[model samples]
Target: MKVLIIKTSSLGDIIHANSIISDLRRNHADAEIHWLVEESFSSLLNLFPIQKTIVSKFRSWKKNLFKKNSYSEFFQLKHLINKENYDFVIDLQGLIRTGIMCRSLNSFGFNKNSIKESFASYFYKNTIGVEKKIHAINRNRLLVAKSMNYEIDQNNISFSYNFKKDQTDPNSIVFISGTSNDQKKWPLEYWIKLAGLFERNNYKIFLPWGSVKEYEECLTIYDQTTNCEILEKMNIDQLAKKIASTRFAIGVDTGLTHLASSLDIPTIGIYTFSNPDLTGVKNTKTPAFNMGSLSNIPLPEEIFIKFNDLA
Candidate 1:
């Protein structure tokens, strides 16, 4: 069977959907699986065992919709997708934009009531209903199982990846200090204090950033702490590899924190404004803890204690 999985954008949501690749591979051993993802995240797909990775420049196209180049690229993507002749096209992303992309294929997606944009359900050939309150990872897995007419071994959910850790430093820890939303960030003072605790214990702290604002925050933390080092700017693929080599990861609610947990590295997710029950890290190979919740931020000392317990 030839299957096409459409999970177009956003790093965290894509990471949640990625957990089901193992389920598809196990249930349909001979199936050839392909993934359609945003171009920015296309590099991260290399860690999965997929046959093809189709890139979509939706973010760019949206900004330059009237440009001739945008239309050319859009048609080029449509042609490539048509040529594949996929047996199943599943849209794990339940958005209006993603829904329209599935119009030409035999597609499956979330039912109206289960998705945020109910109208998107109208585009799918078959819509599967899943409980809205479950973890994002389980919701994606359950949707695929129901659509494919297979059973999921609840005891065996996996985040299987193709790459192995190049090196692991037991005394090294990663501090994911930046998130897309400012409200979700743990205070800078909290991060500095946390880094100091680890520094005194002789643990090497690695700080990574994606944007200029995040880089500045990381630099601030590096300057305040003795052992903190700011990592060079890297793409999703490069960052994932670096995270795999660390002993543990502590971060405010963000995609990289989810990526660390998925890689089987022990991860602690610090939530300041978001609720962990709805979208926290789950179904990983190692211990993954979600601390704090809406309006309740975790303290640096609390995280340090948790880290010590895990250590």
Candidate 2:
């Protein structure tokens, strides 16, 4: 069967959605899976085993060149998607944008009536009920399970980070320092102090951030901290490979954090206003130190205690 998965924007959410591919491959080995992603994050799709990637520059409007080509790209994307004639399409993002994209799909089976989001039975020929109560990762997987008639076993989660022959640093500790919203970031001073702790313990800190704005953030800590390596101009898959090799990881509430923990990489997270239960892994030895407000994350010493406990 041919399937199109619509989960655009939000790095963390897209990474989480990847868990479904293994199930799809297991149950429907011959299924053709297509993914739609925001243009800037399209690089992530290259890492996954999938049929094709359809990207739109929804969030890339900030870049002048991307803004100029948005409409042309949209038309081109529409044409490309319609060509697929997918057997089934699922929109995990659940936003109106995704709804519109799903409606535009030129498919043979759907009842011509569109599914309206709030009134969205108007949009999908079939609408799967996905609640917001669960963590975003599980919720996305559940949506796929419901749509595809596959039973979800909590133990089943898959994300791979296979590195090149020489680049894997087995003794590294990856640090994810960027998140989509400012309110979700852990403080710089906290990172500085934490890096110092990691340095003293003989851990090599590896800082990987996507946005150029994060260069300064990583630079600030990188300059002050010893035994640290800051990765430059790296893509998501490259970052994932680096992260997969780490002995441990320290991350803010960012997509990379979820990626590391989901890969089961012995991760420790610094959560902001967001609930750790919603975004963190509890069963693993990883400690998600949540600071009720992003404005007030725990001190370096307290974080050290948790790190030591994990050790």
Candidate 3:
């Protein structure tokens, strides 16, 4: 059987979607699976256990509205998707653009009936609604399992990280200092406290910064902790590979934390505006501990306690 999964954008969501592929593969070992995601994230999905990837660069080309090549590229993608004539197409993205794209494809089955966004279901001939309360990883897995009429390993979390042995400071603990929303991050004072705690615990603290704002934060955190060292800008894919080599990791709601979790490293995820139940050390079959909300930040002791489990 041939299956096409349409899940686009957002580094973390794309990674979560990969578990569907993993589950499907286990159920149907001989099936051909294709993944569709945003162009910027195609490289990130390379680590996923899928065979093919279809990239949509619409987000990049939207900056130039007058660029004829942008719309032309969409049409070209439509042509490519139609040529595949996949037996099944699952639109996990559930957006207007993704829905329209799936409408152009030839699929025997389409999971759109119970999509989180109702409007997206209008484009498919076969739509299946899935349980929404489950965490996204399990939600997506169950959706694919429903379409295929198979069961999934509910205990599974989503990650694609491979462990690498590093020589420099095998006891390295990474501090991922980047997030999309300021509301989702812990305060500066909390970072200083956590950094001090890790330093006091005989661990080497490595601070990773993704943007200018995060870089500034990294400096502040590094200065506040004598054992902290800031890592300069690098691609997140490279960062994920490096994270898998770390002994421990700490981070906010940024893609770095998701990336760290993907690496399967025992990570302490600090959430402020978000809920760890939705997205935290995902894909970890092992137990997890998360710190969230503004009222209280996670102390190093609690995070270290989580370490005794996942580490």
Candidate 4:
């Protein structure tokens, strides 16, 4: 069977949607799976069993909708989808943009996760309703299982990846401190103190940054501590490969944090100014802890103790 999954943009959601591919592959081992994702995030889909990735630069289109080049590229994508004639298309991203994509193609199914725009379901031929309280991974899994008419074994949930562990440092702990939201960032002082604690525990700290601001911040933290190194900017694929081999990671609410957790590392997700209940780290074979809240910041000691005990 030929299947197309439309999940666009944002690294965390794409990571969450990977479980569906895992479930699908188990049931239809030979099926040709295609993913429609934003151009920036398309690299992530390469790690899965997807046969093709339909790139949609929504951010670009939104910026220059009136441009002739944008119009031409948009229509070309639609034509390309029609030509493929996929037997089934699932819209995991139930936004107006993705909803429009589903409408352009002959959509077979769509999911209504907690964050979905209610109006997006209007375009779906098959609407899959998921309970709001479940973790994002489970929500995606249930959506795929019900939509595809198969039962997903909750006890066997796993996030599939194509990374080989190669990090030489056995006692390396990754700290992911970059988040787009300023509110979600763990205080720099707290990270510095945490690094001190990790150093005392004989663990090297590895900080990965995506933006210049994050890079500068990581540099500052590196300068302030012992054995804390700032990694060069990495694309999604390179970062994923490195994270897979790391000993453990403690990160704020960010995509890389979610990526580390998805790899089944002993990842710690620190949530501030947000609710971990809806979007915290979920899938992991080892210890994964989500700590802190908006008004309540997790202490450095508590973080280290949790790592020592659970990880």
Listed in order, each prediction's TM-score against the native is: 0.96, 0.83, 0.88, 0.94
Candidate 3 stretches with Cα past 4 Å from truth are 65-67, 104-116, 158-170, 294-301, 304-311
Q: Report, for all candidates in order, the number of backbone clashes.
A: 0, 10, 6, 0
All models, RMSD in angstroms: 1.4, 4.3, 2.7, 1.8
> Which of candidates 1 and 2 reaches a greater lDDT?
1
Model 2's alpha-carbon lDDT is 0.70
Query: Over the stretch 67-104, how does candidate 1's per-residue lDDT look in tens digits?
Result: 99998998888788878898998989898877877776
Q: Relative to the true structure, how large is the alpha-carbon lDDT of every model?
A: 0.88, 0.70, 0.72, 0.83
- Cα lDDT tens digits, model 4, 265-301, are 8888999887898788876466778999988989888
For residue 295, what is the lDDT in candidate 2? 52
Q: How well does model 4 score by local distance difference test? A: 0.83
Please give, for residues 1-311, the per-residue lDDT of candidate 3 as tens digits. Answer: 78888888787787677677667767899888888888877777666666788999868667866889878898899889988888888877877777878784543223445455677767775677676656777777776787778987788554432335355356788877667687877777777877676666678888887678888988888777798888766675676676767877778876777666656566678877776787765655533457765666666567666665667
Top candidate (TM-score): 1
Candidate 3 residue pairs that clash: 112-127, 113-127, 113-128, 114-129, 157-283, 158-283
Which scores greater on TM-score, model 2 or model 4? 4
The C-alpha stretches of model 2 lying farther than 4 A from their native spots are 60-72, 104-121, 160-170, 281-296
Ranking by TM-score: 1, 4, 3, 2
Write candidate 2's Cα lDDT for 15-50 as tens digits.
Answer: 778777877888789999988898778887887789
107, model 4: CA deviation in Å?
1.9
Candidate 3 vs candidate 4: which has greater TM-score? 4
